[model samples]
Target: MADTPPPAMPTLADLQHWTWLLGRAQQMMIEQGFDAMRARDPVLPAIPGLTDPETLARTRDFWTDSLTLWQRLLIPQAEPVVETPAQARDKRFKDPRWRENPLFDWIRQSYFLFSDQMLAQVEAVQGVDDKQREQMRFAARGFLDAVSPSNFPATNPEVLEKTLETGGQNLLKGLQNMLADLAKGQLTHTDSTAFEVGRNLAMTPGKVVHRTDLYELIQYAPATENVLATPLVIFPPWINRFYILDLTPEKSFIRWAVEQGITVFLVSWRSADASMKDVVWDDYIAAQIEAIELIRAGLDVPAVHTIGYCVAGTTLAATLAILAARGEADTVKSATFFTAQVDFKNAGELLHFVADDQLALLKTLTTDGFLDGRYMASVFNQLRGRDLIWNYVTNNYLLGKDYAPFDLLHWNGDTTNLPATWHLRYLLDLYRDNLLVEPGALSALGVPIDLGRVETPAYIQAGREDHIAPPESVWVMTRHFKGETRFVLAGSGHIAGVVNPPSAGKYQYWRNADSVSSLAEFIAGAVETKGSWWPDWIAWLRDHGAETVAATGPRQPGEGSLPVLDDAPGRYVRAR
Candidate 1:
């Protein structure tokens, strides 16, 4: 009997040729998809004499630079022919081989040139409305990002090297990974099996004090002997799970607040299904009011401080308005909004998906009664395509690398379904029509909602780089509130800015005592402070009536008026 020899390893040239073929096939598929989309919705209107002199000049410049690059390739020089843009912070082209190898360098430079030219052309379209132009720009950027050289195997030096080093095993593993992700119907941004809802991610000690069709209210066990008399009730956005605030003991804002002598109660929203299709925005507001009543009844407190993150914050603002109209504004002694937007005038890139055509498409897709969680997740991922989508695609599919276990990313991937009626009302009323900020423009629970009439002291926090709720959009919220408002700008984007704890001391926040009319004016007067804004927020709460009292542990079934339903990070959070 003779032993068989192992297959020969592929040469670099062979691998490159194979990758080129794969790239071409992928390009053809992408082009076909784009063509179909354009056929349905033309990106730019055919306006007569729309092309200005600047557009012609930009076209000429693109050709000139492209020709110069070709010339550089033909005639080799000692020094590099072109340098990457100084302001360019893309990590994709960080490999040494990208600059060291003339071929890869040219590919990188050429891609950037094309991206700039395409974006410039989109910007130069003059006759289109602002929203249309913005949509065109977004589409062009998405296309450019999709076709980046770094996304392909042949053009990316690191992927090619890994493929060669592993003798094409990486490609086989990558195929397996892609198939697994496709079956799951979502991209694996982190090691999904590394953490669980109650096991590690949302391990804060608590008991589910109350449960409703809409949410489960978890009352965290007090960490300090003496706690604030007024408890803190948090309403996290229903678009995702609530564990984002309770990710880990270290990163858990819920745990940190408990340790800081604050009795915290957080609402874990139910993941909507077909049965919940009849749920409306008013139901959510009613659920919030119900949670507040439950907290007050169980703890026997007259009022509580409240916090809302993202979309829930918008609802909370409405809740405040409803309370004010009913002469019950004092129920929420103080309100803190975390990266929440009340105005959508400059709502950023997410606005591109809220137009009539896109909404109509969404309506058709949601015939199943609820919008699939994956749909919203895909939209968010597209907002930062390079970081969220392509980065994972390159690692999981191209390089065959598994992502690290990150609690934040784990929480991010745990998406929740949105009821069709509630989601549509939110998009149309709040985002499209910008009615939330306008006094008495919206109503819930049969009360005319007027944000200006709510005089509860507010601590509004905005992420300086937030895309979902632009800081400018958030800043506009300060103007709507007639109460004593303190606007704090935190460093980093939405999730990072809000989940930041004092112990980590990673990013900085800014505060200004002086009044300001606009985001720009606020920034000009604001003073920078190091570390997390949690402590400052705590101080604000204390100043605005968060008095300390003897702390208590999680309540047992017979211990309080509200029965203990379950342990911390309850079943609602565990829902798929």
Candidate 2:
């Protein structure tokens, strides 16, 4: 009756991210001004006896280089700056206006030159620390991205076309969409409820056999009459719902595994909310262990084929490594990780923002105990701003079109909160410190965690084009493990690479036929496979897991001391 009391305004935590970003841009402007003040044209001193040929030569060289750079940047038919692999993939730059036109090309090239020259100017600062320089560079890039021609109406031919066709109606709709999303405190591009989770995405057949405060255990129904004696348990990243691995019956890796005669049990994490503010890193590990123990107690299984995806894979490695250190090595029969990295030496540019300054600013807001999920999304979208942020800007606003209903994007849009304490730990220990990979350098649950001490055979799968977990970063983990590691390089980006099903008959993968002496060498000599790597993983599991017996009545899901908690895709998943 009271219009729901005019829904409460978002808190300071929700508002701090924009403040931090704007502050970064402001910092960049101040540094630019300082750099400009310090910069001076090459000054030539008068020589007494003889002409100073060296100084003259230095000035001459600078003039020559500057002229060449300017000529190439300004000439319509001038040479173009080469694009990076990711940049070459952007369709917006492929437009004739951007590439073929002289003026547009010059504008684009001049922007690149300006960005590079500014960064060089920052480096030329005598008293600045490397951290400060890095921040300045990051901020400059963000500013350049914000002012990209594609982001505005006058320069974007597509926007002009739409405006002309619709007589400005499209702009009106887009403005309304923007306002609605702003009110909801979301950066959403589509109606999230366009497709229900259980009905369209996480539709795999399963039941919630057990749950703890941190996670829900879903045991899938066995599809084959004779299932492997060893069960397959997955630890998916708590950053998102577990349905990523079980999107639909046809595309689901879990469903595929079940049909292959393997008992699949998944660890579905609870969506972190205000109530979960007190949840800490140790609390999460204990909760997962408790759920696994409940399953073991109920089914009386001796060993499990443990798998981890993304951050969950990182946590799984740490948790299992700790248990193995405590002399429980036999608990896990084998280990498999998908795009998960423990050694962060070569982890992607996401770490660029994990420095003390940035984290300190972020922690100010996290005192409430959980980073707002929307805020996290805003920060991460910057890493691939063109695709994740601006692509939607063009489609949702300029064209006045709703984002197409995609399972992966849908799940991505349905983001959930991250427990602040756990998130901070992950960022520092794994991303910044690189302690997890160092033998004896890190300890968990009071036990030393050394992946080198882990002899459990591991299967590592990496996305060849993964921006988050570069394949090299994931491949480097092989050196840490003492056991034989089979590494597969799948084609595609992070999410699409892992979710690839064999039926799709798209995207090729490569296998290092020989041992891993070096990632580059292995890549050069790697044998290409035509289809999905799912079959390769399943075969490896079958060979490495405990001996299989005719699955007569292996415990179905929802058995054990606890009654069935609920059906698959439980309440925790639908929380958002």
Candidate 3:
């Protein structure tokens, strides 16, 4: 596979080149759409004779409703569905200047009408798959969203109000924010001061005991006097920092586990740079094994309970399969998969972007040996433009507001560059081909990776509304594990579903004691439990952790062979 080598780093020239290429592709697609529309019948069907009573009655009712609507509009009444759930939350529109103003309301209604007509036209396009059609619809919506009257200073009343209040200082700050982001390749969104790693967030108090070119292992200091006989080590996706599991003392799952009388260790993958372009999937696999060994040797335990979240879990599942085939599966006593998908058959709408043309473009762009983190983030932002993108546009440019202090959003904005070789391998072997879930169809580290060979029992949790890794895809992971498996249908989405603490008592979890099956049957047989699924997970942990020992806290950093490199949230995690 020939690759387009990215320059040492993205230069202005490189950015402009790729931007133009993308624009060209967009233009071609637009031309194809216009031609398709022009080819369609522009003539209307013959009108029904008014002699028909049903047609005459419908015409009369339409005139009556029009008169009623006219009277209501005169009274300044807004239709209930005029503003969708998503649009209703826009504070600028909430102002009387937008709603009470009849002209603005009329414009809003007209815009919605145009949007509906364009979407209908996109749907009527023939000889296309759902994925292709969805892309067209998404593009149409994006164009409409970009031109929203609220996004402009002249049309947005809120921006005018802010200008009046601050004497244009708000606009100046907004320009500052925009320039700062542009300098960073336009990846930033959240306010950097909102939360600092190892200060207010990711401060669960752990030490980096092992460091490698690919990853670092952090051994968290135990909170309880007596800890579980076996240690619990976590593997988080390298796409972002692992601090999400240790965000805050209140919401940190790692903290909760330590407090539950269990020793905890976290695997933190290093943020790569241009120099690390040669890194590959095998490197990450080796890193996982190295982490397990370091934790096992440091804690003086023969085996450890393992948990993998998102893509990290997918790696773990494959790792376990290889280990089981090698008769070394004892390294992991039990397993847990959180919002992870091993199968891509139903990975969700994101798959639409993986088609041939898109993949070809991605390949060209990533030939630089590493895919830029900002580039990846931009693509993901398009998947949920309203929440991930347009919302920020409104707040940053329209409202001229600094990013609100949000830990989750902050972490989301902090993305990592991925090695090209490894990323392409993943996209092809897993997402595109879906070879991971198939028995005897894939291999890793020269060993055949058959998920059915994995005898390690697992507990899997799926979010109710996860679009990236759909719940159905997560549930499909249970089919390969040979041991007992418990599937939990948790309320909420990918991140919130996994991070929900019982203390908050917000979302509920549904548990089905039966074996692995379709998501529908599982939900039908499941029993709903209010609060987080952490307790049930803890119970399962206790069951796996049969023998207890007198609570000697976790091994200190630099204990024995694995030396403590630095304090928790090491330099790798703190990297940009």
Candidate 4:
């Protein structure tokens, strides 16, 4: 047995295999080095001699002329300049006594000596005899000089002006904050009112009579109080907190919808955690079903209208398809999506960060335990770094300007962590693999997601200038959905696109009067309306709203056997 174990010695073939492996490893190392170098600083200069091959060979030969002399004799004789004991002692360290220690002295000396020895091995690429060396030196100097701190735009007058502009913006932000605080202080008048508002905002105002592992619903007594004819269920993406639609009175979309004689229930998706990791597309659909069941049971309603935004829009679409496949069409009557993508074939360039390598890194991070909220925020920040991050940084940090606290910015910074399991599945399945678009590429709860089966009328809205989710990305849904769909191209970016109030200044939106028009032809003939699109959207949604009915009974404090698990506006804000 011992003789047999020692039988495999390194033959020429084995040696060759080792050589190949070493070469491959070296190549990968070189590639990685190149990546780091390019990322750090990329410099390209005109090489007059290298412009032509004939001259390039001559230039190369000239530079290497001193190679033999330098490499064989001068290089071998090169010695490091040593520091005296006094000089070494003068070097600052928190633990000065350690410098006198033998180990520390030897380690520092060895490091310098080793660095000098390594430096001596390379023959200088410049030479005295080389006429082309002059150009090479010029280019090298230009490149090196360009990277120096002095070369930065801080020294330039125009750059100084831009810097001042950045400073002014920050000051403006600070002033804005002061005003907001003053306004809030004046409006509140008392801590009691402020507390009430904060308490209202911190928790959901509705109660969850029905519950699932993923989502819950807060049901309110029908404000219409008539026999409830239609039940409306609002679906919002969990990417942000669920309170955007329920912000407060006047601006609160949910409040407005309820006040307009509609029986509305908003879906409160629980923030993901380890337990919810494996939750995929199917779980969301099931949650929607459960939510609808609970809503119907409480309201004693027949069907429900669904409104979904961003990720939840697609989720609702999938739910509609799932219900249709199960022949449960009576559950949902109409659907609306705001800035959600169903077709992602041309989702755009920002998705490059979510490509294989980055996705793999992200998935690996999530695998540990939780998807760091700040990490996800940083990735999102990169999509519009120039506008969202750098512009502010240059103004607030570099320009030494005071910044006002913006409510939106404060809210934006309040990112939520993703459950690692769901995040990985989301990136791999929806983004990189684009399972949503590919036929049978992805499934939820063992059910295939076929957009063609979504026959419910859809009202889709998208922003024209949204770098995060471009208008072209939204159009992808039109190509796939087999429904009577109206796609509206709205003005502004993702946030402004969705929250564009009627009073928003100088708003513009495009609408295709005929919902059946192909996206291409619709783009050709779409009419642009001045002012905010919210008025038109609200009017359109109103027409589709559930008809008036008799008043429903009061929301029972403890309906059936389920008591209110938590107060309205539960601990969602505390998440992450």
Candidate 5:
């Protein structure tokens, strides 16, 4: 029977089986997710009209538009042409004509402007939905929960009974006003530029130092005298603002390290301009290399410790690898990455955006200009849109919840533009190509990023609750480094994890070669810790610090009382 024609592969029965199985599986997943959420918060039952008829059509339309854009305009443009030679494809990104694309530029501009308009429209709508409003409604419901009702007068039986008689009419009015305030504050921007004046807090009093030239070094003594000997230089991502690390006097990591006697210098990257648009990834690494040299020259230190945070972390690893390949590893003592991804093999949901098609579209958009901050923010917002983005929508717009103004949120909303050139290069070379992980994949600024060549002792940190950089994906650092390395899983999301103050209550789970059998096992046994991760890190640095030298004279920049900026966390970042 001709071996029954070898039987048809992927037969009709197989196809039908797969179709039914897939349908059932999808249904199960959806039910499971809903069940989990409802179980955790009984208030979820209030969403009985989740699919209200009035909003149903609008919601469907929104998804349809979104899916269409995703598949056609967005997806095709962002996808990477991996099968082709990366070097040749990379060259296409260099053409002057590519930067002039209108669609690319329009979307970048429209993303931010449109986002602003949409948010405003939603805010104008008073009665959106009731049940959805409670999603973000934070208040004390009982005495035993996170918050106590006794703290509020209404919790008392006498007051509660009286309030009930009035049908809570007075309470409702106050709630309306409070909710309005939250809605407005959610997208509020403030001008704090005045705060960028030269003022340094002191036990005594001293002239403040302000170093402006990108090449100039700011010299200040960290309060501690017995600090770590490894010359520590910090590289902060320039995406938002520089002061995230030095947020407040009490929470500043720079201040903390200084008090611990660790020599620390942080890079305050200039907000890039049109001129900087011509600058590529190579220039960035080159700048870092130059900074290292300058720091070494001034300190006369044999080697230095390098710390990179978020995007800066990946930048640091890339620079170290390039330097190492050039036989300059001796200049580097150690390296630490805070929530940075060097291994892109599993870039998580983020990869969905930078996938070949979306990136190609973004490339077209950014051809003539920088990736508008609004566009970038929108992409990130979409990642957890239902929670971070939409939950706020329900509370602020629908329920009129009021949020007290917070410096952190204020800074977060203050967006920064990205140079179109640098943004494209980052996407093409790092995100989509996965060059940093692949040997010789990316040759940035004429130097290849050889992770195996990065011989500096490394400490890598990933956050357990980080949606931006998940633990499983970020832990890839364990396999990439060629030198002595330790990987840590921190407690919070990307921003909270880093800014975690000693007062912050959370414990991180992690595994090290010396302590645990494997990263998975360690994570499984992880326990909660009280207080910030900063103290533990300070202790780590102390153990690594070289013997303290006689307190050296303050290394002021010039004779005329070295010019001081308003303060360490000054105006450059405080700009609205």
Candidate 6:
């Protein structure tokens, strides 16, 4: 018998044409599914302006834009017939092919036009409350972002080109990567193998001086000849690993603080599991108090300077309030808050997930005693879906590209679960009820906590672009405090803004000497200083009462009254 004829390999044009058809089919199915869902249960509930004349006008405008876009596509105009307000700045359409190729250009423009109209409609709905409006906007954006042409294999020019170049091998590899990520139960944002907790990432030299079921305290070996008489303790957010502040030598805030004649201690909160199901807010507060007492006893210091980031900062405020109730506010000589919000009135996008209905749903899901860290991580990723979620979806799943080693992303992906009791109380008290700002409205460790009575000198830093904790929200914290407060605004988002080191010289920070009633007022009067805010913060610490003393060595296990457990970036932080 004659040998079977070999199959012909598809050409680039053939593949492109077929893929375009496939992409259109996929898009049509998606649209049909969305329409059906909307029909069954509308995306937005009945609000005052939803079906009013203004909504009718918006519908007309949307149709007008759609018709104009179709006309432009047929006529091949040099200029776009319709434009979105965000079209110029949208990074998703940055590829030249998105503009040069007529089909892709139309797709990109049409997507933006629809997205803009949907968002505008959401905004125009007048009767809905702020929270509802925000929820609608967030949902609209999420759907629009998910359907962006750049995310699909067939529509994305870069992905298509890569597929053609590799003769479908890219798609095969991408499938494999997707499967691996699915197995892991979370998306891979960076090369996980490139970094390790103790090796390259959290390499700051220290020893775990104290350990509890709640946390491990790491006392860093002094880096200077003379260290501050008053030690500094850092309470990083337990939502993620504590290594964010100790990523690498260049980026490690712990190392930098130790080098600057400050004895540094950091709390690495244990990642909650089913075993920690009953851990509540008071337990965390107690843990912080315990750490403070341990530091005082170990270092022989009367009081310690304390720093807290994110949720930890909120807890620290509560702890301070409790201490004030006990007449022990002086235990913390100075308090520094990094992107922490004591007031959630304008807490930003995070509030979207803390709505009453959402909380009820979350409670049901956390019947296992805790909310999985991956769930929280996914929530955060969805907040910046275009970058953190879809961007990786395209690179790792569509284009079959490997992620570059990003210490920040690696740390971000290393999440920690929230104990069910602690999680619900936090969301209810701080986010849903906004009770933290109300004097004696909240209590912890059996004390009626009032932030107003906590007179500890405070240094509060807020990120200008922090979506998690808006600058306004952080600014409102100053109003709750009775003591002298200095508010400094940093240049970037939550992580970069707080983790910024002086050596990198990346982003700028703003500082104002005079107190301001609002964030806007602070910005108007503030001076824009180049470089990181770390030095300015250090200087503030020194002024707050940090006297120099002989630097001490790392207190190994059994060497002191506060027994050391293991090493820096201890087991609590290393737990999965």
lDDT of each: 0.85, 0.76, 0.77, 0.60, 0.59, 0.85
Mind sharing the TM-score for model 6?
0.89
Q: After aligning candidate 5 to the native by TM-score, how far in Å is the CA of 172 from where it should be? A: 16
What tens-digit string does per-residue lDDT give for candidate 6 at 331-391?
8999999999898988889888887788888988899899999889888999899999888
Error of 6 at 142 (Å): 1.0
Query: Which candidate do you rate higher for lDDT, 1 or 5?
Result: 1
Clashing pairs in model 3? 4-367, 5-368, 6-368, 226-551, 558-564
1 or 3, greater by lDDT:
1
lDDT of 1 at 471: 93
RMSD of each: 8.5, 12.5, 13.4, 20.1, 21.0, 7.6
Error of 6 at 281 (Å): 0.9
- lDDT-superior candidate, 1 or 2: 1
lDDT of 3 at 464: 94
Candidate 5 C-alpha RMSD relative to the actual structure: 21.0
Question: What tens-digit string does per-residue lDDT give for candidate 5 at 199-288?
Answer: 322111122244443323344465654445556778888786666666556656666666666666666666655556676777667777
Which candidate do you rate higher for TM-score, 2 or 5? 2
- Candidate 5: what lDDT? 0.59
Tens digit of per-residue lDDT, candidate 2, span 1-576: 556567688654444444445555665665455445446523544352222444334434433444444455444344545666755565656676666665466555555555555555555555577666766767776776777777787777667778999999989988987788789777775567776778888887888877667788888877777788888888888888788888766788888888889888888888787678777666756665665666666667866788889888887777777777878777788889999998897787777878888899879877777887787777767877767788777778777887676777777777878988778878898799999988888776677778877888899999999988999899987888888789999999788899999999979899977875889988999999987999999999988864665644435665455468799877789886
lDDT (Cα) of model 3: 0.77
Q: Quick one: best TM-score, which candidate? A: 1
Model 1 error, position 403 (Å)? 2.7
Model 4 residue 198 lDDT? 36
What number of clashing residue pairs does each candidate have, in the order they appear? 0, 0, 5, 12, 41, 0
Tens-digit lDDT track of model 1 for 507-546: 9999989977788988998999998999999999999775
TM-score of each: 0.89, 0.82, 0.83, 0.64, 0.63, 0.89
